[model samples]
Target: MATSVDKMSTDTQAESIYFLNAGAAQAEQDRLNRQHRLFDDMMQNDLLPPHVASALSALKTPPKILEVATGTAVWLTEVAKTLPLDAEFVGLDYDTTKFPSSLPPNITLRQADMFKPFSGDLLGKFDVVNVRLIIFALKEGQGTDLLLTSVEPPSQAWFRFQDINWRFAKKVGRDMNLPLSMVAYIKEAGCVDCDDKAYPGNSQLYTRGREDWISRTNVHVKALAEQSLRGITSLGGVEGMTTQKEVDELLACFDKEFEDRIVHYLFVRAWGRKPEAD
Candidate 1:
């Protein structure tokens, strides 16, 4: 029998990945709903500053906003609270588990599947639609994400074996984001403005901000390398499809990828608007 982590990672099949869009949103969601308000302000940092802010300042007033895949709905809602009181806000997602009944009146939460063709009354709407990491969410639980970091020597051996297959997937582009498709989908829905950029966040449990981004990211790099190892072992063992040597090769490759980031670290923060007519 597989452990819980093993079960979570293996339980993810293609079909079930349909409803498994919980992305980095998990961290954000937990932050938003945590019993303390500290997480909301624990920026130790900043917001869409410099580049994005320049564009944001040019936007028309009280524009309508849609935050797709609104998990905890905290990020958008909190930001909305600081908006020009009249700004129209909407949060769209399939799961409403934490949808709050009490929120600023201007903020509206809607249950809509953006993947489908939006019609009639709602066809062409929304001024700003901020979709962050929605692609990673497309297929959640797709693999057996075992974490052998804490496992004993034997399981560690299995983890080392699993890293091989994952390396193969990354090489071809299974990790690529569908920028054009998403842009067209929003455009067809009547959003006139669009921009695609990936600024994967740099997080460090004890460190903070641009100054500490590298240290935080170093931790992340290690974590990713470790994950690749565990994932390879668990998935390949059930089928006898991978070897320990291949796993080491993949781990070494991934470790190098992360090591290079130690000196230079940045994140992508992108957004676009729907022309007023839309």
Candidate 2:
């Protein structure tokens, strides 16, 4: 269950000024929610391992969880169902428009920028801080750097692996310039027991409705690619590296590659725990 925090309505002007497209925000949120659902289903409906949940459940007091850049707060709400009744969950996002109208009493939504430093009260308050799929919004190393300095002791941080292969991106005609490894950043942040695991997807994972899932995923990917293309010229400020016509051609190529099952995507999750004071 989740609870809504008392906060002002989303600032439409700020959102429009800050985001690439305000309208696309909702679409992206829907796509991300679907992706989270797919991951959970693929992992047998367990968001984390039995041991992780057990460790959190054993805390003397209710665990306080924070999710940075929590688009739609889908992950927090889903995981909250498995935790103790008193466990508190907070989903922080810069934009509040996508937050649900109602939430479980234990869950709260906060509108905050993840790029900025956390307030003193927020430092080290959470048992777990979760982040996922904000790579497109972040520059290389920016997200990981913020997490490293912001979280407090006894807190665990988790980040989903994003493929930042600039070479492969250049071949596809999209220049994202992402970092080499987010997991490495976590280790640099002084978190103990940092670990990551990758999950490769194939045709068999879809099982009952493989074609349908693929069709939907393809649509989502196409939309994301389109958005990324638009940002290429705008956000990257790379003048004349590729024309709009070239981007269209590349997108077409991507669609065909995906349909032909020649393109594969990998999903990875990394986690680390902060050591208690000396």
Instruction: Please report, in order, the local distance difference test score of every candidate based on alpha carbons.
Output: 0.47, 0.60
| Cα-based TM-score, every candidate | 0.49, 0.70
How does candidate 1 score on lDDT? 0.47
Candidate 2: the clashing residue pairs are 1-104, 2-103, 2-104, 3-104, 3-107, 124-152
Worst 10 residues of 1 by lDDT: 140-149
Query: How many angstroms is residue 149 displaced in model 2 relative to the true structure, after the best TM-score fit?
Result: 31
Model 1 earns a TM-score of: 0.49
Query: Could you give candidate 2's per-residue lDDT for residues 2-66 as a string of tens digits?
Result: 23322322432232212233345667677667778666655566686556677898889999999
Q: Give the alpha carbon lDDT tens digit for every residue of 1-278 in model 1.
A: 33653443334322222222333434434434541232223332334334444564567766666787676677677667555788777887655545676788888776555554543545456655666435434432221221212222133333443343334334322323343345555555565455544332333333555445554444444554444344435343223435667556655655544442432223344444545642
Show model 2 residue runs off by greater than 4 Å: 1-22, 141-180, 203-206, 230-262
After aligning candidate 1 to the native by TM-score, how far in Å is the CA of 197 from where it should be? 5.6
